[model samples]
Target: MHVYADPFWLPKQGNTEEEYEDACCPRKVTERASCSFRCAVADGATETSFSGLWAGLLVQAFGSGRLTSKRRQETLRSLQGRWLSQVSAHPLPWFAEEKARCGAFSSLLGLELGEASICGGGRWWRACAVGDSCLVQMRGDAILSSFPIRDSRAFNNRPLLLSSNPGRNKEATTMWTSRGGTWESEDAFYLMTDALACWFLTEAEKGQQPWRRLRDPQTGDGTFAELIAELRRNGRMRNDDVTLLRVTVD
Candidate 1:
């Protein structure tokens, strides 16, 4: 059995051609000899205050690499607590100051595919956010799951959750863990931030999964490159920084 992993990050248009305000990394863990894990952190802009810093810090904490549901919450709490301390010292006058030059939110997605299970967490959001990062599962021609962003009725882009304030009410970032299931050798995982995700899923529904298009047996040159060029040519996804990753399990 083999696994394939690919990650890409792009900035929004007109912003130095960098669509990502956060940093993402995946490392191997020894605790699980048969499985691999990946962690991603998407930092919000600096003008948003300490969001990016907070998101980055949380990813750093998971360096220990043994993630459970409890640990995920703990990691987020620690992130929040750290942010609160920093803010207490600096006292941000406005929320925008905490973000980077652009309004970005730390949307995180990770996967740990063990011999017996697959565990993951969706992106970050506050109480009022209307959307969320999607976690898509692919098995050949079928789409298994597309976890959409879930939020309370009041969510309206307020400062959601940050790693700096550990003691505050932890915003419930979504997590999925399956212990007993059958994942064929052809199963694949796709994680994407908002804009690119919407584009990909919409295309998938229209019988055009971007990855499938790129992997088409009959493509000439490179379909992925062509797709990128087409996107840039048509301004289809020039609004936000785009980050996309695909991993295949076998």
Candidate 2:
């Protein structure tokens, strides 16, 4: 399978260009001609611990590689073990002592195996979160499933992992599971950070169809460019870093 992958990382406007950074390293790990995967991680900069660092590390560990169910579990365990061990042995007293007010960042992954694709489960895949990042699935023009984001609840900052803290549980929960079957030829999948997701859907509601119209063949600008244009023109995504990963199975 040929992977049509494009990644855009930019800082919130007004800050210097250097203010934005991405640890997302997109890679094709295997030589299998029939398989391709798209993965992305966006770390939240402000957290009691480094959420972005953990998010990036977790994605890098599992996103690029192929995994059986067992290996996937092992990978999650090892990541949590290593991360917590490092933090415990050499405590960052400064980070621990101060209740630094920072929101959590999210990690999303989508792997296409022929027609069926699995989404979002590199440790804490089904876990609870405070922020409202979401995953959307589409088959042609219809919306399939959107992962629920809990914003009104008290447990907003906590992620649904095996151990809430790495030191406590080396095993992180699996977030991605198959809905059971292949995506049709016309199907497409989209996952985005909350800022971008909310804005994109809002535009779509206005009949702007940032996504629906982008599928038009005449303009030929491409999906990423069209979406970026929408974000730049509308002030919907100015408050945070805007990252979007889209998968279309033809």
Q: Using lDDT as the measure, which candidate wins?
A: 1
lDDT of 1: 0.49
Q: What is the C-alpha lDDT of each candidate?
A: 0.49, 0.47
The reply for model 1, stretches above 4 Å from the true place, is 17-19, 27-33, 41-47, 61-67, 81-105, 117-131, 149-182, 214-226
Model 1: what TM-score? 0.63
Tell me the alpha-carbon RMSD of every candidate.
7.4, 7.0
Give the poorly placed runs of model 2, Cα more than 4 Å off: 14-33, 36-38, 42-45, 65-73, 84-106, 115-132, 148-164, 167-181, 205-207, 212-234
What is the C-alpha lDDT profile of model 1 across 88-200, one tens digit per residue? Answer: 66544564454322322354554445443433542211111112344566777777666443222222234343334333334454223222233567676665656666666
